[model samples]
Target: MKLKHYIITSLVLAVNLSALAQSGLQKKADNLFNKFAFVNAANVYKELISKNDNADYATRQLADCYAFMRNPDEAVIYYKTVVQQANVPTEYYYKYAQALRGIKDYKESRVWLKRFKDAGGDINDSKFLKDADFINTIFNAKPQYTLKDVKFNSKYSDFAAYEKDGNVYFASSRDEGVLKTHNYGWNNEPFLDIYVKAETDTVVSTKSKIKGDINTVFHEGPLTISKDGKTLYFSRNNFNKQVLGKSNEGITNLKIYKATLIDNKWKNIEEVSFNSDDYSVSHPALSNDDSKLYFTSDMSGGLGGTDIYYVDIKNDGSYGTPQNLGNVINTNKNESFPFINNEGSFFFASDGHPGLGLLDIFGTVSDNNKIVSVINFGIPVNSSKDDFSFFMSEDGLSGYFASNRDGGVGSDDIYAYDRTPQLKIEGTITDAKTNKPIANATVTLLDSNNNQIATLQTDNNGHYEINIDRDTDYYVNTKKEDFLDKIIPVTSKGVEKSVTSINANISINPNTNKVTPITELQPIYFDFNKYDIRRDSTVELDQIVSLMKTTYPNMVIKIESHTDARGTVDYNNELSEERAKATYDYLINKGINPARITSYKGFGEQKLTNQCNGTVPCTEEQHQLNRRTQFIVIRMQ
Candidate 1:
């Protein structure tokens, strides 16, 4: 009996000790997670999950760690398990939805998004709620920018390019000639350091560490410079005077530091006043006039994750209070990397907005220091991975940004891009009546101001094509020998395609001496009892002027005007005669020869198309039909 009792006590003791070990492991994992050391924390969480100890909590934390690290492929796997359990936070639904989008599973992403909404998630803070077909809108949009890889990218993470004085400055985790002794626990890469790529005649020559006391053993870089080249600002880990500062949670947040140029070298480094040990402040950018400094931070009372804030730079060199950019420019997710162009346009990166995927760059339309709306830079500029650190030139045409997308040389790579894409207008010119191709037709392209841009002739197959600019209004004027000339208004505005097809099919009637009513024109209506032409009538009248002035120079036409029956016969006669004279004068003013107009006359309510005479009550539509002007082709040669 004693031996059996001892065996039972030993078995209980072993079980209790195993439980105690698991409890200790859980505490260590939680500490790592709180410190933003997701990589280290993830390993411990996975161990706990494998042993089925605190499986629910361990699984959730593992998924969150992956999400924070931007490893969506791993995040989705664990999130799938966490979301299925009961009493889960609604934020997990949102995180799961974003993770699914990172993998390009938009349909399933939307499902969880709706679930997130149903579970009382405040989706109103984002632009996603405004567009139900947001995914398709992004995927179907035409690419306005083209990206090319740079030569200096390394196998590790490299990004945040800033150009100054013919030298490109950027941050990289590349190991140099020295042995790698320090590695960041978050990414398992060497600590970031600022490097300069020297450019001679616009060609990159050599890259080396920046010359100064700027670089340290900890993280540094993603910098900006002043216009006069006397000052520099950059982000670094919260370390100064050979001591690292940490928050209560034991995380070393980032801070902004400024350096002054002295004897051609950067020195006198000092941290910005707004930085705190409780939160992070990084990714510095300057406004066009250098009157304000913009940055990203996770300080207290922010919208959610990191948000963009700006501080006014006084003339005395002191900073004003940091002000948030507001909800229109922020959301409940991460937003960072604020940049402003010369025209005062604000640009940043955000995962909170409706984007193709994680951390797409967005621009804002602001009025009077308030952001009114946001615009996504759409595909090719954005991808399924994280894209940030947008910097544009003063002209707003060419720029650089960083992305961690596929087919890159590094985990994050810098790409030089231009807003100009190859846009084309192409189609065939065919005969309207016969549906046959009209070879050798001349097509003229004109700008919105009617300035001639280019001229092209159709090929033997009646195919014509011309390159054009995006977001522009154009007029395509096509002419053949015996066919009617067509001035088709074509616009590239809001077009999201590489090629826009517009066929200029010409219609012709060569038979002469037959009265050809101008059926293509809109109804030319004048005001009641007025002899002058209305402004709205000019577009229709211009067609007549164009027909006589360009298409058929030898064609002759006459104008006939009429008035409604409600007016007196004598007064109507006077008004109609004056209206006919006004139309004749308009044609002559538009460069139409006076000889082309054979005659002008007025019917004065004598002819009626409908039976709405004085004896019947007529609606406005019936009365409007009576007030008309007709341009009759008396001769065509």
Candidate 2:
């Protein structure tokens, strides 16, 4: 009897192991599907379905993958199998219609679309099909602009063009000579980095990698610049101390960071306070006043995929709670690369909206806190491929955007678009006494309403230029540290020219001896009593390292870290000391000289911000305020 029981247990164990193996494969397939690795995910689901268990679900996922890949022939096979089965999901019916339409089977696609609507797809959802007005709206659309590929595209993916001053900035995955061992499994391409091209006298030139401390070994950019051009908000893979941060499923999420221009370099980097590792936040777009930030995130509470969300920018440079744009602007599909013009015209790309194919750019106007109008950009501005990251110049005539349509220079390309005649402003900044060109001086352009239209810097030749809409009064403010700010006003109210240059020679009074704190640097915060460097804190620390390497090359500094009043005094002291050393090590890793760090010390609970002392009740937020890392300048040589 004992032998019989042992044999029975072994038999059960073998059966359970086989079941777990099949289940594990399903999870692997699901992860691949989520990441958009369609080809590999389809293979995995195919093998899973061969075992017959959960075959219906596996078939549906496989069909969806093929449909996403635009392989309608293969997708229709599995989609038909699933649709014929009883109790199929309403979405599957709709997806079947889309797959059939991909093969130009309009009549059969209409059949499935009708079934989808009958099974509860809203009339609005079915408008893309069986709606004459909607179909004709796409068919009868007239081209409003001409698009041509820019010179900066690479053989790999290159996209997300944003113009700042005279330079166009974008992200690219070109094989930049750096020998990175790992390639993205999805496309087998190198990670993205921001590239720039100056709008030269006759034409926009080929792009070059942006210098200073911005580019890393990982993905970067698809960024938005502040009107003053001194501040940049960009998307990057979550990282700490040069290591990528991944979620539990081994997927790296994106986060937004803020950095400012100091002296001639982009420094003072800090992650927006609300970024979390559990989800992604990327594709930043700033309001005209820079007081509101719009971005795309797949965090909890979103409609689905990645929804566009906005956060109020406080005066102190911190971000407020994020609010969703709601179902009107978001759908079960992704909505990303949001760009809002000065006229409050909202633009975003979505796959959920009725469109030509994949992701299509959509324009809308908001009034009284509601989406008043939403229309597809249509025709020339869109195609049967992914066309996103639409940005128009202030003139509403010409601009730069990105797309992955066929016949492009690379997997994606920056396209220069011209619609109407636009205005251009050009100038230079110099020292009044020496008459030498001032490179990297920040130039702020303000409209008649005192709205910051753009902020940029003078290049090595002290040259600056930007596109502006005609019929506007404007002022240009060129400023540099140790130099008196120069403001030049101009009236372009009646100028109807396509491109005009305003050649103003800005002169500034130099005051090199004055000592001013590095006010751009913000205090880095840590979680509880943790000392390990976090993704959010690395940006701030990188700023310090960058400042030391560039503007204050010979400056010495000290790290003063503190802890909250929660832990025992001895424990808090050790934790705070660790935090200080962690910050010190981070700077050293970033190539800062050890001799430049005068001291690394911790104050523990001795430096509590509020009365969050021993017996005082305090909220977690208040306690977090006490745990801080401060950078104190020791000397500037």
Candidate 3:
């Protein structure tokens, strides 16, 4: 047929014309997508399809709409169509492969990946793997250290590990070379001491060293080894350069110390006093790849009774502040023996809350870092006594931790059990500004996509902890009423990869308590019959401004006025609107941001507390009940 005579040319042109004509629809589609209205965007794309069947690009856009909305189920279909298009570039094949994987269709996804690669697609797409849509908690990785009762007679507790070359070093209270004696824990001798075992095949041999020269007469345990095995760091109670020293109270205190490993043996033992004194600073765990050290100390400047602390070892080998592990981990109840595994696992013991007894071992895995999965090692692993001081190795398998089980030899005996199935993450929570712990704060745990896992309030000491699973990304957010929320991101880069106490420091300014004292933030009241200004309003506003000036000086104030149901709806609406505007203008004149004022909505008579009909004249007291002015806090500086 001749081009001019045939109607097909016009028909095809008409489709293209319609495709271009859908400009208005395109804007709406973009707007919907911007607002995360992906489902609706897909519907709009569908309309465009009905209008112009030849719109291959629009068809593909529909699928992309679903992908952006994370609706993989629907996105897969559209992506396939996009690939089938004759004009689709090879790069588009890469996008298609990812969409198929997004829907959990690994089989189909692989097929597309092959097609993409065969079509000259870069292999980088494979590098970016999306976290699975679901989680399954399976105890993976072989145990590095099992529960071990090192105590010859009685067991106190043990934690912290030192891996130096071929030797596996750790803290224990079972027996030492010198008398095999230790503080009875209560008052007698403590049996705690640093023990060394030969690591034949990534497993600590039973022939680990006991009663080494480093284990003096008093107590010696909880050690950290440098990468070169040249430096041996540990904590001890009853400090002295020699066997034992004297202190005032029966302070079961601990101080950090280190010695040089000479000729495959520890020598020139020294006490770590960079930030410790006559107090307790035990449970020292060194980072696998970094000089940053982690330990538990009862130092006077800590946030609470017993807390975990960290110090930065600069390139020059100097120490920084003994930063408290913060409220995210430490609590009023003794939180001792913190051990982190490189396989995304954090182990510690707490007698504070939710445990079998004295000190129960717990594991915490952060999902999106907002909700913390707090799981007790369950039964058998935890007894009614102090069962803490746990450690784990890189393989995610058998590790060591001391427990005082019933079958042990004495009051406290060392016992070894399999590490539980769990995941671990470490980070800090501190005031954003001061980089200090937001004491007594609340930390919430969330899963990969920000779903809440669990929440724990930081003790007045400012630290939190919970056991979690290895399945999903865990995010944590630390929040206080008037402070900005903080998030601890849960990346699977290995929890123990970089060893610093998960010291998440959240910056929180002290909540401004304006001299205006209303006691509670409930609905505010205003004087009746007048909209000018009340004395009480000034008092409240003063406090409001006080807080505003300090925390959010530049924030805009949205003043909303309300009235009781004594008048017509229209009248009340107008009156409240005027009152609200008046307040807004006043704040503006006083140097607050007018641009920050996001306009006040007047609910007016709609939300009246009473239903007094016009026929009945309600008392003034009844009418005064609903008169109020409410201010919304937008954002703080």
- The prediction achieving the highest lDDT against the true structure is 1
The digit string of per-residue lDDT tens for model 1 on 1-637 reads 0000000000000000010112456768765654335577789999988987567767877886676455679989998998997556566787678778767787998899899889887664364433322322222223444665588888877788877777878888886436376777666777778888877534322247777878888888578888888889899889988989999999888899999999977899999888999898898989878888998899989999888999998888888999998998889988888877666667788889877677787766444455666656555666778878877766545678888888888777778875553456777788776778888777877777776655656778887765566677888888877677788887778877534443344443332355555566455887767878888899998987777767777888778998888778999898889989988898888988898788989888997778878898889889878888887777777
Clash statistics: count for each candidate:
0, 3, 100
Q: What is the model-wide C-alpha lDDT for candidate 1?
A: 0.72
Put down candidate 2 lDDT per residue, 411-432, tens digits, no spaces: 6776777653324677678888
lDDT of 3 by residue, 334-443 (tens): 77766655633455676664555677666553433321333355344566666766655454434454545556554444444443333333344566566776565677
Q: What's model 3's lDDT at 339?
A: 60
Candidate 2 matches the true fold with a TM-score of 0.46
Quantify all predictions' global Cα lDDT against the true fold: 0.72, 0.71, 0.55
Spell out the clash pairs found in candidate 1: none
The weakest ten consecutive residues by lDDT in model 2 span 4-13
Candidate 2: where are CA atoms >4 Å away?
Answer: 1-142, 201-207, 421-637
Error of 2 at 485 (Å): 58
